[model samples]
Target: MKKFIHEDFLLETDYAKELYHDYAKGQPIIDYHSHLPPNELAEDKNFENITQIWIEGDHYKWRAMRALGVPEKFITGKATDAEKFQKWAQTVPYTMRNPLYHWTHLELSRYFGIDELLTPESAEDIYAQCNSHLKKPSFSTRNLVSKMNVEVVCTTDDPLDNLSHHITLAESDCPVKVLPTFRPDGLINIEKVDFTDYISTLSKITGITITDLASLGEAAKKRVAYFHENGCRLSDHGLIHAYGYDYTEAEINKILSNRFAEKSISEKEIRQYKSAVLHLLGQLYAEKNWVMQLHLGPIRDTNKAILTKIGINAGVDSIGDYPQAEQLANFLNRLNNSGSLPKTILYNSNPSDNELFATMAGNFTGEEIKGKVQFGAAWWFLDQKDGIKDQLDAVSNMGLLSCSVGMLTDSRSFLSFPRHEYYRRVLCNILGNDLKDGLLPHDMKWIGKIVQDITYNNAKEFFQFPSLVENLSLKR
Candidate 1:
């Protein structure tokens, strides 16, 4: 049988074989952004069932389920694992031309060591086999990380987390680095239900009263300090648009005052409160030298009933028509003027925002690798072939591909690591084709080296990997 993955090298034509061969050699992965849990890595947790690992928490499958008209019961509810597997297999072939098709097959090939495509006929057997593997002690989360060749993975987390898990992972002798990304978008989603609990939690975490803006700020500062102590060097924000309403600090303090009074705020006032909170967070990030990433412009929760039933991420998100440049101007202008901006990487879902977001990113000279500004690779629903190509082109044509980190999994699935290899192959295919023709120089060695650097080496260098510098393999 043919190997699903090849080690021979040079996935390009013979003319460019030597170059691609040299370029595709083994390099450590820098997965700087992901939704994976830190505690799972710390615990080296293993899944009990195939469904538990694949269907339990993954929103990708949830989206497909909604698309296929499968009820939520079979997805995240009472349906048996076997029943869910059956539904998924029925939908698999129809996922044609979707990235999920490739990812599912790739995972099957790589992890389960099964080359055959998953269909109704094969689902049960494949599920049984993979379930068996999932139960093995060697198949724990940390083991999965090692097998995926992940050197560093940053998981999205709250400022209030104890980070005990992150500390545990660091203390373990594991070579893979599991870090945290501070996601404080919760502070922006201030409704009565969320705000009350958030404040209570913040108070408990920081040992301070979160009654007013000052107290809230103080509590958040304590959380950020704890994160830093545990090796968190990054923060992330998800927004509908980069719009942050303008207001005087005193006027903003009034909302904090209102929240303290337990009074309901108008929708417009909520925007002001969020904007003020954003500026505060931005200042904190810069003060601490943390990387900040923004995922902007998802018209989220379009399916109103589904949203009401299931809460957010119910596969109802679509592209928003919000003003791109205009929406971003106010907030970015604040950061730019105050010079309180951390290293910023912006990801926008709307294709029209491509140029605007890229140019806006260019203005910051910011974060991670620093000019201090950078644009992110395609993300979420936009993490597709065409979207990725557009992002690479836009960044390369507008910014510098040399500074661009290439791709991040942004996944909840351990099996999704091949998405990295997929991105790398696509990059090589593009670059190789360019060099094969006359668009790029025919100096295979330099071109290949650059490709390798972009695929993995650059990511390793750009993100905070204070631990890896001690590794002897880093010298070469």
Candidate 2:
């Protein structure tokens, strides 16, 4: 049998094949947002086996394995790495029509040069082969990034994180620009039991005694400044919906004082506090010219039992049915009215909000900026082929697709870089089909340039990272 993933994989037409090969295939990736650990890149850590690098911290694979009746021991438990690989291989063939099947084979082919379908039958050989490759110096984390032609990768970071690893990467000879993105969900989530503890930690970090809302904002601003100096150009927030509740500065201060005193806070008070903090941070991000990314609509940690056992982000989350439009508009309008709305990217986990997010993004475009408020790439559960097509259609129909920044991994695994290629193929196929049907002009050069822009150039210009721009200039 021919390889499932070949040169023409996912390219259905001659135009599709031509566009992908000529315009999209060789473009360098700019993963402007992801959950990749910076310390691994800073240390150039090499995995001892494929499972260590691929299975660990990958909740997608773990979720699939659990669906196939694999026990936690094999998924994230005391099973040996070899056993986990066996369980994953056993689960692979059953994942047909799912994105994992394609991702698994693509990673195997792209990284290990092994195109054989992963199965219980072929598991041993493939596992051994991947392990052998892992032992090579070229398979180290930094080399893997270079192998994928990644120009820049911005890792999500906590506001209180020291970012010493990011500092190390910046000062080292590492080719890829690994920058940090400020993620202050902890600060925004005041309803959590450990909120005061997190505030205390932040106070210690900034040497600002957190006694009131003003001091809290002062400490947050200091951290934002520190992150900007350390090459951070983005801030990310994870929320079920936008917090746009109305409240005065006095009300927010009272709420913070109550929380600090270990007193009960009403739901209205919680929303008010969150809105105040988010609004304050939005202005600060604008001051520093940093992009703010809002990842919305996921109801996280639903399975209380599993969460208690595995902690958070163990794949128990699902797309939430939140009323996003009104609050989202209110928040953005408030920022825009204040003239402090930074360049923002809105990502929706629920597909029902596709056109809503697309049109909403179009609401706040800057005269000098192209697609300033962006409907970000299909995210989380929506990063698959069908979800990608739907998001692209929404952007093309409701907004400017050509001006939009393209795909990002948003993944923790180094091997997930082929997701960009997967997205590119889908993109070329869409445009190529339009050309074949006479829906678009037959000018390949013009369309090809647009494809190249969406694949690479758009993000480079949209983000405008100093080090990334300088490095790409040197290469030119």
Candidate of highest TM-score: 2
Q: What Cα-based lDDT does every candidate model obtain?
A: 0.76, 0.93
- Superposed Cα deviation of residue 6, candidate 2 (Å): 0.4
lDDT by residue (139-183, candidate 2, tens digit) is 999999899999999999999899889888877789899988999
Per-residue lDDT over 1-476 for candidate 1, one digit per residue giving the tens place of the 0 to 100 score: 66544542225665344544567536667888898877778878898877877777777878887788988888877899889988888788888778888778777776778778788898989888999899897788888878878788889998767777877777678768888889986676775467777878889867998776778788888878777767778899888877567777787778777776788778878888888888888888888878778888888877898778778766678878777676577887897799787777788888877878778778667433544567888887778777777887888778777677668888777777877767766666667667777798777777777777777776665565566534222100
Of the candidates shown, which would achieve the greatest lDDT relative to the real structure? 2
Q: Which ten residues in a row have the lowest lDDT in candidate 2?
A: 467-476
Pairs with steric clashes in candidate 2 = none
Candidate 1 residue pairs in clash (backbone atoms < 3 Å): 343-367, 365-371, 365-372, 365-373, 366-372, 366-373
User: Pairing residues by index, what is the TM-score of model 2?
Assistant: 0.98
